[model samples]
Target: MAPQRVVPLSLRKPTHAVCVVGVEMLVDVHSDVPRGARSFEVAGSSGLEVIVFYDPERAREPTGRFRWPLHAGADVVVSVDRASKDVNDLKVKVSYFGEPESQALGHGVLYLTGVDISLDVDRDRTGQVKRSRGDKKTWHWGPEGYGAILLVNCDRDSLMSRDRDFANSQLGSLADLQDMSPMVLSCHGPDELFDSHKLVLKVPSSDSKRVGVFCARGGNALSDYKQVLGPHNLSYKVERQSGEQEIRFYVEGLTYPDADFSGLVTLSISLVDAGSLPEVSLFTDSVVFRVAPWIMTPNTQPPMDLYVCSVVDINGSNGKFLDDMSYLAMKANCKLIICPRIENRNDRWIQDEMEFGYIEAPHKSFPVVFDSPRNRGLKEFPFKKILGPDFGYVTREILLSGASSLDSFGNLDVSPPVTVGSKEYPLGRILFGSSFPNSGGRRMAKVVRNFLYAQRVQAPVELYSDWLSVGHVDEFLSFVPTSDKKGFRLLLASPRACLKLFQEKREAGYGEAAQFEGLDRVAKRSINEMLADTSLQSDSLYVQKCIDWNREVLKRELGLTEGDIIDVPQLFSLKGPYADAFFPDMVNMVVLGKYLGIPKPYGPIIDGRCCLEEEVRSLLEPLGLHCIFIDDYLFYHELLGEIHCGTNVRRKPFPFKWWHMVP
Candidate 1:
């Protein structure tokens, strides 16, 4: 083939050579130059340099190089003018070239911005995460283990743009590329990871090179990353970092093991690039994880295991009462621990100097005794420290005395503690009556609540009428354990039931009015006197209100139905004054495990019935609880005391330990 003649540059169109720099390189082209010109020079904008190279051996190679000004994602246009004679200027177009696409090779640099790690212990039950600087390498967890959260923030520009498929694939491939990835996080120790055969955690992802194993030096790997996140159900999303694209990593779960896991553990975290040729890697300081010792408060449960009461030998008043209580304690198969009288003086001093009410044995103090787990003997059981308000009395024996507080003539501020519970939670609540300033007021209630909470005891306060002669909760209500499905039922005083019985008896022409006709004037006069007293009327109103309030409280708070309540019939009466008057009381009974000690209802005969003992038994027998009617009127009830006032019971502890359950 014949060679084509070379055209003269000055006679034909002007040729151009373009070089683009400072931006990405996309294309390069060089055309053959005309043979007539020895050398050519091109000129353009400032801050640019052009170099021309001439080599005789390589005739086709471009002889010139130029540095041009370029912006990211913007096109660059070059105008080449012919310095030779008689030639026109030619315009050459250059493509745009910005930063690279690879995350490690992009214009933005990857940096470890902020790291947040939190440790939570279950013993405190606060669910608070303690922030750590991660300077320390060792951490401690409670016996029930703990929960944690780790946050890793990366520079925004280092992250790829949003592409669901690409992101998912990268996350899916993480396991395979973990060895080459930049960061590794893990926990190491016995049972370090929950429910996994291998203690190490292998976070699965599409791009293992992007996210690798995260660990602390002494820590073990997290078990089942997916399972650990099962509770939180975490999700990922793309975000901006410093005005640039970013990807966030959020991992939360229960990381520590149970009490069985103890000793030192290392949590190591490291970062390194796994790109074609990586040059950067980072490692975080290790943290410590320690398992603390298990501790818990011992609370009291019910079903009386031991009976505690003081024996008073003053004026021989409580001798028969003591005998009856002892016999009842023996019948119930409970250990009777009799506390001696607070006054150890002679009988004359006790009878003459001390008030008759002060001789009441159980009035001295409210003893809450707890036995240690290692102790099995009842005699060695020690009393818990006084938790409630302190009464200004000489001896600690009057700590919870109900004498001054209950008497209407004295004060109604100090409330006597009454422990009660339901079938769902036996002996779980310590019930207290509302107090006035004269009694132990709201301050006492606050102190009691705070004390119970501090001691890990759960209790609730209930409202009761202070207008009654004896403003004690035990005067109107009691709790008895039953063999029924409900486990326990509330015993309440019902004047309506007594009135109904009296009316029915009268309709049959054998009521109290008809049987005891001679005592009618006395009863009628007493009723008139009670109605005349404004304080008594106020007391009646308060008593009705208290009954209504308690009914609702029992139903709502204790989860009790009408069937779970047993109403005992009794009528109100006035003897002398409001303080000295005595009303027919029945709910002031004692609970001895499966036995119910009730007062023998001694009053005028009605429908051939002189006493309601048989009726009371009939009403309670169906509930699967036995009843024992004792004559407490002579020594106890008549003297302004009830069965509970003369006795107390020390209960057994619940079987399950508190530490075993989740906080």
Candidate 2:
């Protein structure tokens, strides 16, 4: 094994005041000094001084450039301090076997490698803290601060066991050492701390140079280099010839160590003229820095020639249709091009619609996310030319070049039941027609009823209907919904037949069998009356007159005076049916309670108005019910089904308190 080299990372001749250029002060020696080796000490108030040592045997007056092997089983120590002239500030002594000094000066570069840092627990162990590297460009939460002891590697092997053994063998000399674990240090200043976390150790680079040991904390006799590095199975030997000059270096079996270097750190040694000469000194200075990792920002503007056509009913708007297609593509693990273009009348519009892809920008949105598709470039599709006359006249082909997601299909319908395989109808229903009464209870009931009728032959499945007309619901429930209900086993005839029956009945003026006007009429009835005989509640009314139901509940609950009429239809306009349901519950609890003479909480009594009343809470508690108090009825599924509250509120509020039921 070649000698392991050690460089002074920082150095300056002893000056008026003690200053360290490379690493911090104290240096550790691995073994006892050999006979005839000279040690150097500085004592003075001079501005700057240098330490020079050399062997006349190797080359007289050691100067300029020279390399000496760091032999195994050798240890060298260098000490420096502000020595006063009165304390016999300087002294020099030379013995036989130790040669004369040389005078040479030329700068040489060193590269440090094969370094190791390890951790170990102490007896009656006290805990040590080390920070782990964090994510880039973001602040991170920190743990409580703690001190870490230094542990260096002696055995330079990859396997931790060898290093442990080497470290243990050196533990005997470290009795005063309180901890044996390696100190993992971290840069904590607000600046980019990651940069300073690394130590760039430089040693005279050579194939023979095997490894080096280092510590930020000063090394003492109590510090066991072997115990700290025993498990590594590596070693370093340094000998000061001719009073600490011509420092000999050597290495044994060793391995590489891990480093999280994010910053630039400098480590170098200063060359000098003579060995065994007076005024030999040690210098140290360290540079600290923070580093920032590279980051890439995205182009925020939507691409030109890309326009989004939104299809609302999963049936017409191109925009809506595209959304569904994107969803399907995602499910199939298919990648697609983002920002596809769509023709609007005569002008081409590009849409930045980003909802389709993964969104990383906190407030930014994108239509598609993932790897770009296999092809690129804009394409024009002339549906008539490629897909035949079945395709419309405006045919333009979308040219895809390179990897991209954009794909062109001559006006192919991509809506429901469009499975990848199914022989009967290779392309399932692609055309989406317009729907009336786009929202609300009327829309909901019609959608549900239609879906139910379509799948009448199958088990009655809940139609996952949002808002749609009665006719569409009939078609959906009877056929489509039933087929997808997975094997519940109840089926009904086609939707067309059911729709005919319903229209015929309506024409005959028979009306709903419940014989009710609409939701308005149903809401008009007192809560007490509805609760007493829920059979009187009507589904048709709940569907047609939601405002009537809403206003009636409101009037009853608030005790509206004459001429206090509210615009029923306009007041109830909102997007979600679920939210609409909440308001009705508010009416139910407050009005019913007021009519039944329920008392309100007395947190407020200003100006004759009890402002902070809990009347709604008091009334709904006993029935395991709570009013949303917003303009909707959001009863739980169990209550909605069992109590049939919307259609049948015949039962009195049940006898339970709000606290009695566990949420």
Q: Which candidate leads in TM-score?
A: 1
Per-candidate Cα RMSD to the true structure, in Å, reads: 23.3, 27.1
* lDDT to native, each model: 0.35, 0.22
Q: Per-residue lDDT tens digits of candidate 1, residues 34-133?
A: 2322322234333232222334343333333321212111111221121111112123222112222211111111111111112211112233323333
Predicted structure 1: lDDT = 0.35
Q: In model 2, which regions exceed 4 Å deviation?
A: 1-22, 25-663
Write down the worst ten-residue block by lDDT for model 1.
354-363
Query: Global CA lDDT of candidate 2, please?
Result: 0.22
lDDT score, candidate 1, position 241:
24
Q: Write the per-residue lDDT of candidate 2 for residues 445-558, one digit (tens) a residue.
A: 222223222211111212222332211221111111111222111111111222233344445553322211122323332223322343322322334343333234323432
Q: At residue 629, what lDDT does model 1 achieve?
A: 67
Prediction 2 TM-score vs. true: 0.19
